[model samples]
Target: MASRFVDTHRDISYTKDVVRLHSHAFYELLYCCSGNLQYLLGVDRYQLRRGDVVIIPPGISHRPLFLEQLAEPYERYVLWFSQEFLDQVQVFCSDLDFRGGYRLLRTAGTPWESLGNLFAQGCREAERGAPGWQGHVCGNTMQLLVELHRACGKGEMPAPMVEQHELLDDLVQYVEVHLAEKITLEDTARRFLVSQSTISQTFRQKMGISFYRFVTQRRLIAAKTEILAGRQLETLYETVGFSDYSTFYRAFRREYGISPSQYRKLQQTQTIPPEA
Candidate 1:
């Protein structure tokens, strides 16, 4: 059986656009090495600084928003852990709680140093893949989480940098609740008592994406989640707001580089191994 519990990588000069606002079936821990970006966690937005850490739980929609041109390439260490891996760590560290929505740790002084060291060590182990590397990475991850839980207990977490925009937040939440219906920008603008241009500019200026594109991305993410849950691909297009299977198929292929059926088969063949 595979002994790997976490997938880890470091991006030195990452400048790719994460167009899809999607969720995962596992945990995501991101340590910002150097970057200037705002992160959208659900409806909340955060301005990330160097040494900031963001922890996202499974099934929560998230993506980074690049409102302006980056003066420097974004650098960060990203770690992905299976739910089973975290569950095992939780068993021994019962005081650490993992049943939360998301956490943004803005650290300084000793806590920042410790977390950065852990992230670097984990990345190295993952890269080398030496003998017993899996165990080493697992230990490092547990320690990192434990440290984070302690930091939270000590009140090191900070509030989101950007104040919540009531209209935009409500509109995003509205889209999430009514995602199954045939949603249109005109209808959304009318419901929110705003002009179509207002809605369009809000999405473009604030979210770095168009309103229609945001809705479509959300729907595609929902469809992807349902497919992972073993839903019938043929029955999902309409349910997820796509007019037909062909449209859904084309969008899915365009966004994810594979057909829905192909994605399902790929997932099935590479299911993460359970904890021993």
Candidate 2:
């Protein structure tokens, strides 16, 4: 395995349509500088505020839920590190919980500003690429992790949960269960005993997208995940709810800017075999 693999960057504005629910093969840490959004982490949702930090482990699906347009540009700092790098860090601090599922740290009364500064410093180091910048970025990351551990130890501030609309939550779960099947808004409405208009309006108001669009995004995400896992692309569309090859090919390329075969080859080249 490589000695270290880390990437850091800051996003100033929001792209509501392009931001789809997805998972990574590495750990992700996000600090909300400013945002009006709900975050979908696994099965739970969180209403994010300034100074809030979110940590997610590999293979856990997540995305920002844009319920409404932001008055200000949604700003955030994101850091991604491979598990190999985290394993090295854990040698010094084994008590830290990086694999205990997703964490939402509310920075109320905590040294959140300092934590945010660490994120900024890491981003700068990554972007400048000066001599010894990797070590500096790693050091900042370690200190940030240690500070977060200490903050969790305080146990004074608890993570606040978002009050999700029960119907919307059920709708999402239903879609997940039926992702491989042909799902329609009318079918969902009839199943839930509500009018089709209600279902359409609910998804538009709560998810910031039409019901069909959300389903398409989810299916495409699933197909991408399977591709990364080394699945054959020939019949992958049917398994992910795409009716035919051409439809899947067009949608996948449109959403990801590359063909599925191209994406598979790119990932294969970038992948590093684990040390024996």
Candidate 3:
């Protein structure tokens, strides 16, 4: 079995507000210790209350909006770990859908206290870095997952997650996979059986970007990866779904503030130093 060595834990108290649109390649669990914040996940905006737990899957775009002026810092504990770690825990609790997007586990009853303790323990173990700390952290994470499963089973998790979130997630993935193809908004809407307006609205609300801009930026990102890998710029445009060089050049420049050629030359120069 492949092993994963990535684990992160942070108990942060943000004095300033936060706003950004991004995604991760690992699972994230946020324990709201004390703070009222707005969390945007997919097309849904949630008012996160104290004692609320938010679970986010990999590659799902989400952002947290903090209060501009706060009497106290927005406090929360964030834990991020590889899916492999979640898989190991899932072996013991197989009914849970770990890959599901945006699971909200409300803190209530005994489970709430138990989860808080688990998060606290995990944070401590991670920070202490004592002998066998990794094992202790994993143990705490496993217990936390188990508790969340129990809460979901009892329907205490609520309907914070819905099919629309899952659908939007699938839509994003589909676009990524079909990036090289001449996939249009209409094509996506037709493929997913959703109206163009709904798709546009979801992108705006969740990603804070329009569908066209999102696709163009994603293509530029993909192109940058290939260019850094020494792929020729000649075919990079078509390979990454751009219809023409002029269009690709404009989009790349607009997104990166640098033309593709300039970007590639910069990457090459960084890798190859001048002769002494």
lDDT values for all models: 0.78, 0.79, 0.69
How high is each candidate's TM-score?
Answer: 0.84, 0.82, 0.60
Please give the TM-score that candidate 3 achieves against the real structure.
Answer: 0.60
**Candidate 3, residues 81-133: lDDT per residue as tens digits?**
66667677668877867675676766745445568778888888888999999
lDDT tens digits, residues 127-237, model 2?
899999988888899888888888878876676776556787888888889999999988999999999899889877766678998788778878877887777888889
Candidate with more favorable, higher TM-score: 2 or 3 = 2
Ranking the candidates on lDDT from highest down gives 2, 1, 3
| Top lDDT hit | 2
Kindly give the stretch of ten consecutive residues in candidate 2 with the minimal lDDT sum. Answer: 267-276
Model 3 RMSD to the real structure? 8.6
Query: What shift in Å separates residue 146 of candidate 3 from its native position after superposition?
Result: 1.2
Give the root-mean-square deviation of each candidate in angstroms.
3.9, 4.5, 8.6
Model 1 lDDT, full chain set: 0.78
Residue-level error in angstroms, candidate 2, position 181: 2.6
Cα lDDT tens digits for candidate 1, 1-276: 133367777975445454457776667888988878778887687888888888987667888777355667778898888767877887888777766778788774544556888999999998998999888888898888888888778765564466456677888888989999989989999999999999999888777789988898888878877897888999989888999999999998887777888777766665522210
Of candidates 3 and 1, the better by lDDT: 1
The lDDT of model 3 is: 0.69
